[model samples]
Target: MTSTHATGEIQSRDRAPGELTLRAAWRWWLPPALVALLLALLCRDPFAGDWDALDYTVLALRGAPSSMLFGRTLFIYTNHYAYKLAHALFRVQPEHAYLLFKYMVICESPLAIIGMWAFARRLSGSRQTATIAALLLALSPFFVIYSGQAMTEIPSLVLLTFGLALHLRGMQERQTSFVLLSAALLGLSVNVRESVALYGLWLVVAPLVYRWKLDARTLGLTVAACALFFVCALGPFALIYLFDVDGYRAAWHGWVASMHMEEAAHPVTPYNFLPLAFFFFVAAPIVFIALPFAIYREWRTRGLSPLFALALIGLIANLSLITHYSAVINGRYQLTGLPGAIPLVADFLLRRAQARGRDLRRAFWRVVVIVSLTALIIGTPFMLFAWPTIQSHALTKEYRARLALLPDDAVIMAGGQTVAVTYYRGLGLGRWDVIGTGGGWPGARLPELIDAHLRAGRRVFVDADARLWFTDSWRGAETRQLVALQDRYHFRRSADALYEIRPRTDATAQDEPHLERLLAKPASKLRSLVRH
Candidate 1:
């Protein structure tokens, strides 16, 4: 009898804490499904607005000579490399670049979701709570807004989350390999996006949450893991800089100078970091209101996941500070840290609701659900509806209509319409030979380069009224009249005056034989991107 009792007790202890039977596993699928549904709905509209920098980046990826642009930023290299590899493997088609972009988002987004689920499961200690946290991340309007872009933030978020998850797992199991894996992830995260600089620091700085106890050996091992991670992740870039000293110096100086100028100017007021900080940080009430309450409720059952909490606060606060210093208040820059933040917030809310057991319990849960649902309802329009509708959102339909009227195989002097031109050509709507001037590519020259293309009998498309490209008065009224009189090129009414110029003579026609050959290829046989 004594032996049987001992065996029974051992068996019970060995079983997992929570019973995740088939029914329970099925329930876990709910949140991820909802997340997928929401992202699909938002991406239904074509990506909008012409972001000039994005155009230049995409152009570089599409066979624009690297020698023509400066050395890549941390982000630029990752995005450029990813796109190039994807293109090479699949034979990148101009007509399917948008599809290619969509494939990247759809494929990489799951990493963040999985990361959130793992982080939540570890922190909350309940599969149910973790599922809710993962769902919240998937359903967030902020995430939905960014998931379809050809940007590096989402991938960065994935790396950070994965790193955090590995760290948590290592701590739980007392495993050295997991710790090293975490460090490797943190290293990769920093390179993937510079904003993850904060996350890398947090790994070193955040308090170590010891469930049991730690000796000097454990501490030393942890520090060694961090050092190894930094070396592994950053070694390649360091070597590149060491060998290419002049190039690295020039790129760094130019980048820092541009960033400083942008910060000093602070052109975007009202919406910059100072204001958004309230929504994300200081008002802490907005993002972290439930944190303390959840901490209190779980205090008896589970002490706060202190390291994760501190990491959350540090990453967010740092991002807000950086955002304030930027010229514009772009929310996407902080997205790399969001994979971890969403789950922390969600777990807090769910735990608080679960704690209030009897008195007004229904009302309390109702309120929690209402606020979450309200955030989605109110935030959706801003992220999805309004964003895509703005003329500056990406490229307005107006720009597309105007660009369509130009010759399909003409070299054009373009500065501002790189994004629009890229999208139109990538979509098979039209193809124009592009000679980009502004927005800073590697070998970008001024009007001298434009002169070369134009003098060689190529059609030129100046930014009819773009002050950034020419002297303020150059694109003024008289210039518009002069462009019209100069021959077959004229500014057609676009959504916002994106000019469409055409060849007026055959002398200009023969200048782009390569463009003619590409144009002759059927759109159907062009790149068939695997869209998500």
Candidate 2:
């Protein structure tokens, strides 16, 4: 086995003698930036897609209260403050706040690209390898898609890659300040997205990978560093608790309970690893083909560098956590470790090209071209079709117009679109009764909740076609509550699957006939009305 430290050894062997000039650095930076800009332009949408996007948009437009800052407080605050700054300085109108926020968030893509370059360079000690890795990540379809959205994934990734880069560099240079800064950035990343806390495993395993002996002082320092990491991670939450003790405590408990419930709902099994496989094969085919070979080659050559070990550990930890608890398989979930994997693959490919003259070098270029084209081909359809289709379901002007048609005093009962709907038509406009069906209340108690609203002489408008409430595939408590609601009240289709709920006694001759006709439709037909 090689005795020198992994990253330091690589740097000593491969890096150019002189520091990279501005012109050379710009050559590396420009491609990823241009690619990100092009993708952002193509995938730009005024509205948010999916539940989290909508929730984030609402939080950005309206500042996140203590109740809303469960896992992603920093990300929410970042967007919120950005919006506030734009509104104050740039004179951005309220109507355009989300659009501005979307672009601002999208900017993280280029920053992430640059961060990946720095990280990969630090790992492989080759600017060429780093550039290739950055471009590869820039072209990633899932990365491109998420980049143009108002979400935390890309920002978290940006912080994570940069933090890892600094940490690696600090270890290489023996700089305590760099290490401490890396810890701070990592902690902030945990605040942005709690999923990043998984990377803490990498930090713990890192010293051991560098072949540090398991002695008392080493163990004590490791423990102290980890303690510092946790303290930094929890610092924002601590401040939040200090300001709003009850609210923070309630949110924390609720988040923990939801996590438990989610864990129970999606128990870990052998099949859970399928998503990790899917991430490699479907999401990043190049990495799928290259990473194993890279690991094998590196293992045989230098006995597994700290860089390779970091990548492998990060990939395993992230994939394990996601598959164990998350019900859905998403490419974004794998992104935290994807940057790390890219460096290893890039280093391997570049090394191969250098070692084997002409033909193998041609093969390396061919692989890059093929992989880039494949990623674009796979991602283009999603960028053009799937993303827009999802965004269409957001609280667009059309949906808002339909909502405006309802009585001024009407209370909206929504499911997944609850945040968006409430944001558009909630207490700000004096309509404070947008009840979310996902309030964790019992289905049996749904009637009692509705009865109170009705007794107060407010008309209740239920989103009958909301996917959460009406999907036949869903057999959750929400669906049961919807069925119970149907059996108890006479539903008058107000506009585009929006139904006005009234008591059975209140059903006049005109209402009764319409209600009967609506009820006569088959279950499939009713579900067909859902926009999903």
Candidate 3:
């Protein structure tokens, strides 16, 4: 065993310096390097996740109050103060939010791999087990997909795992410094994503679980330092609470409202964990049937070790959260449970072999897990690249082709992807402006905004992605309104699916019947001039 296990007891090293250096390099550097190589292979276009075009609206605030910008105190849109931190520290323009977002996610890849390795090492107490667990995490499907996208999931996972590594080591070693760092990191992680705030429970229990004396004078300064850092880490939320208590309350209510709405989206029941289980073990999900047996044996025989407590609690907390909320869709939402769940995979493998006493069965399953994961891991990027190339080129080509239909100085109004519209506008297509529809149909302001666009000598392009608007509860009504708006404004479908909202040259009757006829037709694949 390495010196790390004994918690302040160092074993004398008989190994040469070169051997130690090589071991150190492997321990700290190799896993991260491999994760980085994987990310580099798939970081290009058709990136895994996309920026919520809605969230980007907050950039217009420029760190001001939401009330000041949008006339709302709740700030229902999370600005991701973490993302704004990039703008403050790195001079990233709000227009380039996706760029900064992708960069931040990419940066988390190596740290996340290292943290996963350390966490597995601490829990399993076997270098072999640790290596396999870290490999599972690094090769995880969601991790691979989210690594290059502008999203909060992977970033939160990185901080959560790193903090766990620190806290677990701190508990075992009775190291106040590590616990302090862990507290701070966990605090900062809450700011990154509210989902991890429950992880704070681990912070409160660690000291007593480790038997660290509260009355000890030597620990007083350490306690103070810990408190100070923890508070400092929560500085962003604290400021909001202090200065904008009303706004903070509004945000809280808004979040709860959103949770309720999400929960209402799907029929969430206790059985939700069944799918979550399947998702976590997706690489070789059949082995997941063994999870309960392994968990029961570990609990009955070994009891709940403090080492595994965080992971168990984390998994339970996430499941409890989803059980209450209707909107939990994928296993990706439950990723906080993944690091904790990984050790069980190793446990299942180790125990299965011992149960049958057949090395071949264990080895075969291990190969199956790896090969299945390999198929998913390698095939996903190829598909991500392949599907997007065709879809994007078709979409872009369609956008460009309709663009030629408009006058040269036409000012186009778009709902989403204003950046892309602006880019095409640069190629003498038309001027562009965002006319947001609250991710749905434009409010009563549509006619006024359209008239404004026309007054500026620009043909109005009313919809950016009418399809995305149908995802929520407003599907039928919004679609009906789009049809109505097309009829009312005498709009025509260009070569593509969009409506051209130009000022009328002739007063045409509203074609409500034609619009209804178009809607009643069966949906099919988009006919594009470009072939697959």
Task: Tell how far residue 434 is off in model 3, in angstroms.
Answer: 6.1
Residue by residue across 1-532, what tens digits does model 2's lDDT show? 2212333343555456543432457776678768876886676554754457666666566665334334477787787788889889989866566677678768778888888888887777766677778877888776777788777778998998889888887767756677767877888888877777777776687677767678886576567667777877887787777776435677767867865665665566876566556555545667777888988877877775876786686567556654544524355676766876888887776666545443433644665676678787765654454553445555443456666778876887765556656656532443536776443433567788788888999898877553434333333445565656656777677777677888877755123213223233334331232212
Candidates ranked, most accurate by lDDT first:
2, 3, 1
For residues 1-532, what per-residue lDDT tens digits would candidate 1 score against the true structure? 3322332332343247444332345455455745654574456335522263345355435433122122324445555566677778988754445456554655666557666666666554545445656665565554665565555555666777768777767767778788778888777776656556556554554335554345686668767877876775667566656676435555555656665654544454554544444334322233445654544543534444543454355456445554444312344444454554555455455444444442223523454465567566656544543452332434433456666656676554444455566656655666676654332331323345545666787665544434223222212222233333334332333334334344444343322111112222222110111000
Stretches of candidate 1 above 4 Å error? Answer: 1-26, 44-92, 205-207, 211-214, 245-253, 267-273, 278-304, 311-320, 323-328, 358-368, 389-418, 421-532
Instruction: List clashing residue pairs in candidate 2.
Output: none
Over 1-532, each residue of candidate 3 has an lDDT whose tens digit, in order, gives 2212221121122123443232463754475447654763464324224433223333322443332212221122234465567668988764455555456667777677767776766665544455556666666655665566555666677787878778777777777688777778776676555666666766665555556677764367356545754574456665665676446547555655654554554467766665555455542242344446656655665566554465466566556655543223344565566676666565445444434533434543564466356647654654454343224423432455555665565555443344445445433345545453333235555677677777776666544354323322234444456555554566655534455675556455232224443345332221121011
Off by over 4 Å in 3: 1-36, 43-48, 53-97, 207-233, 244-290, 323-327, 354-461, 464-477, 484-489, 492-532
The all-Cα superposition gives candidate 2 an RMSD in Å to the true structure of 5.0
What is the C-alpha local distance difference test score of each model? 0.50, 0.67, 0.52
* Candidate 1 global TM-score: 0.65
Cα displacement (Å) at residue 230, model 2: 2.2
Q: Count the backbone clashes (under 3 Å) in each candidate.
A: 13, 0, 3
For candidate 1, the per-residue lDDT at 219 reads: 69
